[model samples]
Target: MLDLAHRGARLAKEHGSSAGPPVSLLDQEVIQVSSADVVGLPMRCVFALTAMGFLPQSAETISADELIRVRISPAWLRLDARFGSVYRHRGHAALVLR
Candidate 1:
């Protein structure tokens, strides 16, 4: 997936467009990964972008999948941050010890 995204980003860059890469939908049966797990891909994508110096350290995850779906500028890797927010917010919340 990362390879695909890189290739896509390269193409977009060569074309002098803000668009990144083509979106790909993996088959659950073939990949054997749940939808919940699938969500991680976006986060990884963001991390990849960050690693590539595309975004800053304070950068947050947006809806990359949606951005790809909407045909908006693909330069930014947007993704649903709800899953990450859940864990991040929980860590800040009061911890109840049973």
Candidate 2:
């Protein structure tokens, strides 16, 4: 998932996206994460990915924390996996999580 965000930023740069990468979503900062047991982690991931344009921006007013706390549907998981794989293949496969 982090790879996807990295790849998204790379592609965005290649295609001339004007918005600079968000500080929190920077590849340097993101790659350091291995495991986290923090509350709202999923919400944070969704927010970060969406902010990077890896995931489409949502129009719904539902907060990320609320949505994640309620449920993580299988379909959403599949989408995450699909996007991760796609980005991994596109030159972000070097990420090694320990």
Candidate 3:
């Protein structure tokens, strides 16, 4: 799991408020780890990896079958960290992770 996986993600919440689902950064790193179709997200820099930073997801959920679906046109790629992760499914809604 990437370092970012240990932090709390402010996913699926209203904008500008300190309330939402708390996702551990250490866990939930794999939806279908072996699936080749899975898109990986990169681990951002120190500043970008802070608690104030996260892959803003507009909509994310897990089905009974455990199929993790995510939607982001411009996936996050941290060239420096060389780490990859994924944002929860959000269709096309613009969400801020900070």
Q: What is the per-residue lDDT of model 2 for residues 1-98, given as tens digits with 9 covering 90 to 100?
A: 44455465575466543566444444332322222321122323543546655443444633444321212232232124212311212234467789
Root-mean-square deviation (CA) per prediction? 15.3, 10.4, 14.0
Where's the lowest-lDDT run of ten residues in candidate 1?
82-91
Model 2 C-alpha RMSD vs. true structure (Å) is: 10.4
lDDT leaderboard ranking = 2, 1, 3
User: Candidate 2, which ten residues in sequence have the lowest lDDT sum?
Assistant: 81-90
Which candidate order results from sorting by TM-score in descending order?
2, 1, 3
Two-way TM-score contest, 1 vs 2, winner: 2
- Which runs of model 1 end up more than 4 angstroms from their true locations? 18-50, 53-98
Cα lDDT of model 1 by residue, 1-98, tens digit: 33454544465456543444333321111112233223223333443444454433342443355222111122231332323211112122456689
Top-scoring candidate (TM-score): 2
Error (Å) of candidate 1 at residue 26 is 17
Candidate 1: which pairs clash? 62-78, 62-79, 63-78, 63-79, 64-78, 64-79
Better of 1 and 3 by TM-score: 1
lDDT of each: 0.33, 0.38, 0.33
Counting only residues 3 or more apart in sequence or on different chains, how many pairs clash (N, Cα, C under 3 Å) in candidate 2? Answer: 0
